[model samples]
Target chain A: MSKSILFGKTLAELNEICKQIGLPGFAGKQIAQWLYQKEVYSIAEMTNLSLKSRELLAQKYEVGLEAPIKVQVSADGTKKYLFQAKAGNFIETAMMPDNDRKTVCVSSQVGCKMGCLFCMTARQGFQSNLTAGEILNQYRSISEWAEITNLVYMGMGEPFDNIDEVLKSLEILTSDWGYALSPKRITVSTIGIIPGMKTFLEKSNCHLAVSMHTPFEEERKKLMPIEQVYSLEEVIEHIRAFDFGLQRRVSFEYIMFKGVNDTPRHVKELIRLLNGLRCRINLIRFHPIPDSPLQGSDDETIMEFKDTLNRKGIITTLRASRGQDIYAACGLLSTKELVKKQEKDY
Target chain B: MQSLNPVLITDSQPIANKAFLLQFNRTFIFKPGQIIGITTQKEIAPRLYSICSTPNDATVSILYTIKEDGVLTPQLSALKAGETIWITQPQGKFLFDGKPSWWIATGTGIAPFYSMFQSGQKPLKLIHGGRTQNDLYFHQEFQALTDYIKCCSQDSGNGIYAGRLTKYIDEQESLPPHINYYLCGSAEMVVDVRNLLIKKGAEYHQIITEIYF
Candidate 1:
């Protein structure tokens, strides 16, 4: 078996590992500085550690950062990189560059279980959850690592589904001993798994983004299966109760699917559902997928919908569609990489 | 964290191959298709299971297949009828709307469907998939339904389709685009079946899924 990965360890976990290896506890912080701050490629490059300590560490642990296997650049300069995850599975990470901002969207799992009608990732079903190291590697291993101004957990699998690792990655990114980045720059998205979402909201300081494709429960059930388990009403109730300070944000991601959910009724319900909640809604243009039953709402319909929400005092913004040519949709590229096979009985 | 209440098991018996039917005393009223999380110790995270019994049943029955390398199953399967089990409140809304629809399930995924059947909310048809004849859990009870199809991969005879449900669905010329298609199973199975139904002309909005992830 490969040596344990030391790259993803939290400061406390590192301290535990160091204590077990006969090294002073403070060496954990030193190792954190090298692994996170210095971004060393190998344990041998951690020169500050004594030769004996380095030998001990190298025998049992490796840096554990794997670079992307392939990269596809969009005409708009949005680059999508595919990384090999556990087993033979692959995960895609997209780095979208706008005028002064560079946002890296990272996937939390290899594929996904959230079977949203508009999502391409669900076709691959679920492969496995990516570790904190794997999650962070997307942000750190990319060529534009230094230029990343924001991180959004909206690439593939639901971030809250892999809550432990997602939280760990956020800690690594925001902790002083880690990247020392501000928590405001990070946002974790979910299809509303209540338990995991609650944990993320209570434990982490990062912003929360929920995929609320529709406001109605019956409509949402068909669009996203998670609604059957964790209803949007319950999710909203919890968010309404949680103390997300003035700085922390909770945003709803609404994917406009033509006549399906783009209507005055939806807008009215969205306002009623999100009544008194301090949050904004990001209206995303739906990307057409193969054999999809729905179509993206026309630009006119989407604009009117956004304007209606904004008129009702609900902050709404249109998310520009980027990387349309390079399978910019979160699951499209990774789904193409999947080898299709005939299904067998359970 | 869920507030777990200690409940005494009323019955424990092996149902299908490696699967067990565990029944515990009921404490609260819940919808037929709601699920409850169970564990031997409160400290350990409880695994959620669909309640196979009806909402008004005297006891809350759950169907579970023992995972050889699982954390909670080994402990749960070892408990006796009188042993205590900690459980969360009845949760989830994978409810049947008493509409004409098809309920598709495989293995222990049949629990919620069985709950609906027991609660008198019959699907137009109940299609269940399993590996063998024994895996067709509650088939005798489900037989009462006018349309019950069993797709068994490793079994023959006894009115069983000799393949997977996905193949059966694919072979269908067309499925009703208007009626609901309630799918309950593994994520892979749900995705495949949902996609196949979509390809066969069933509306995407017509398929409701409950994934055991």
Candidate 2:
């Protein structure tokens, strides 16, 4: 059997491994440097370690990074890269370049269990939860690894649903022993799983973006099933309780559905629900998927809605759609056809 | 963290293979199709279970199966009648509006539908899917319904459709397009049924789903 990969291990996990392997305690830091700081692809690349130690490490561990197997570049410079996840399942990552900022959208799970009505990923029906290694490998194995300035956990699955792996990936991305990226440059998006959201708020300093497509409870339940379990009222209350200082940010992602959620009533409710919260509203244009009944709100209606929110003291910005040609836009990332078939429990 | 309230198990019995119907004394009123968060201890994060009993019942019941690797279910299945368990107040918006609708479910996903049925709301049809004849819980209660259809994938018996539920839906000459369709199951089952319903001419709005995450 192949040994576990060392690339995704936190400093403490590496320390545990070092102790088990009978190496000096400080070797954990050295291994971390090679696996993360240097981004080495092999255990033998640690020339400072003794040959015996290197051989021992190689016997049980590999760097565990797999490069993207396919890439589809959009006409507008957005690139969608596909990587093989566990058990022959596939995941897509999008790299969008805009002037100086390069943002990479990474998936947290193989597919989504959250069956949001507007989501294409939900159609795939959740294959497996990606390990922290698989999650980080999407960032590390990409071609724009060096220049990528922003990371969003908004690709395929609900990041908070896989909270442990998502938190570990965040730690690896921001810790000094890992990639050491700023938490400000990272944003984790959730459809509002309360327990996971609370745990995330208490543990990480990264920005959070909630998928709040509508403000009304009934409408939101039709659009996103999570609203049924963790109501929008509860989610907002939790956010209100958390003290996100000036540096850390919180944002709501609203996908405008033509006739459903684009009306003035929704804007008023949005303002009322988020009255005292210090946050921004990211107004996203809905990207229609196959067999979807909903259509995106017209540009004029979206602009008007944004203006109403801005007038109400909420800092609302209209997010430009990207990678639509390659289906890398929001709610469009899915690998349904590539999922391995198994006898479903249902 | 949401505070949990202590409740005593009033009854616990196996309803099907690896599935159990657990009843606890009701402490709060709830809609027919609401869920409660359950845990063995105060400190542990609770898992949500759909209330399987009607609101009028003296005790609330929940249906669940033992997931071999789950943190809660194995312990939940081992509990006796007098033992204590912690649960949150009833919550969730998957309520069935007494409208003429089709209620579809699989395995323990039948909990919410059963709650609605026991609450005196009769669906236009109840299509239940299970792997075997033994997997169909509460079949006797549903057998009286005029449109109760049972689909067993692996086992075929009298009056049971000998295939997947989706197959039975696919073979339908024409599905009622006007009535609402409520689906509850794992993600795969819900997604598959929703897509099939849409393909068979049902509008997206007509199909409401509650997936087990």
Candidate 3:
């Protein structure tokens, strides 16, 4: 049977690894303890394991954790870490340290499938899902992990598209059996995966942030291709069923694209779409990626839009754009080093 | 230290929406009316969904609505049986203790009350306001929990006690003493209900609310 990149590995998979490495089957739990509990970087650091067992395990399946190869610091405190995927794909993860909390942006895939007209990764095209191990490494290897209080899936790939591995990683993160971070500290961003969105709402209790850049379908389709399949009207209608009236906050991610979707009429449509909903609108500053036709909306227009939403009784705030200097802003997350390496190999 | 006595509490589809029943483990010792935090799971940092399952129940559960064109709700809709998600220790101030109170809500803003109702304190009345029948979630629970007054504002469905929640509250001739008004759901509903509660001679502190975005 073929094994998954890193998912649904029952305790049996760990037992298989242990037995193959000449250790007792029960020793598998110890290995899990080291990997998920202690987060040991090197097999040599597994001092508690028998030397023979460590040697045997090292020969075949090395603890698959790699440190970040390159780190770029932006003028703002945002730091981007570049890592080589198992198959030589390049991926970038961002760490945004703030006053009250430090948030790390983790990528779900090497690239994405949504193909939003404006997103850089979409322009590059879709890649494979990051293994559960690969996804977890981004958190364990980041420089600010000690201070990191929050994580956002608003990085590179579409999280819902890679649901299995993503959910597995969450188990490790929240389970007393794993890292044990409260579910409250994590936020996932999606371009609207209807099927996946429903699962996430029922299965996960984390805060939900939707990338609702535009409430109008035609205009939204210009920026996000997913809008074609799942219309904005439909998305709002679906949301009308659940109650966000508790701590689980529902926030919409609105990226202001210069005069195109930043007019007064746009805000009116937004207010109408969100009229009865109890959610906040996060007005984001658009970061220009290479050769993208869209332009970032001017600050004045964004403020006006925000003002209109607030005036209409919707809670709206201008989200501070971070990591621009190091191409860590929205859609500017493709790793330059990885691109260069690919060119050299070609 | 977290205890490990997990229970499957209340699981029901509040609305015919694509949303699902929010399941929570009974690890955290929760009391009736205590709120909890829902964070992103370590693996996928999807946005958080604060649920309505307090620790007091045998199992914790909440109502959910899917987002059709939304990133979060759409992604969430894909869950299957036996898959685990992250949850935090219970934390919030929106639960209704045993008091004479009313909860005003609109849209999915009625979610948290699923947990509040299970938290064991029955209020005197719950004045619910929504646009249509599709908008009014948790009807049975509301019926069982307290004296419910339905207000369909935009007339999505007939047979609802017509008008706005604010209008409904204003028309009430007399309210019980020490009435604690709890408000959840839409931002407009909060502002409107809060103002109405004040006009009805309720103290500012007497009116507690969990303001949805």
Among all candidates shown, the one with the greatest lDDT: 1
Candidate 3 is graded, for docking, as: incorrect
Rank by DockQ, descending?
A: 1, 2, 3
Cα-based lDDT for every prediction: 0.89, 0.88, 0.66
State the lDDT of candidate 2 residue by residue for B1-213, as single tens digits.
Answer: 678999999989988789999989988999988999999898878889999899889999999999897889999999999999999988898988877899999998899988888888889899999998778888889987899999999978699998999999999999976899999988878988988898899887787888787
Two-way lDDT contest, 1 vs 3, winner? 1
- iRMSD of all candidate structures: 1.4, 1.4, 19.9
TM-score of chain B of each: 0.98, 0.98, 0.77
lDDT string, candidate 1, A292-334, tens digits: 8889999999999999999999999999999998998888998
Give the runs in model 3 whose Cα sits over 4 Å from its true position.
A1-29, A48-59, A243-245, A330-335, A338-346, B1-213
lDDT of 3 by residue, A150-236 (tens): 988888888887876777777677766567788888887877766577777777777778898877765664456455345667667
Provide the RMSD of all predictions against the true structure, rounded to 1 decimal: 1.8, 2.0, 18.7
Better of 1 and 2 by lDDT: 1
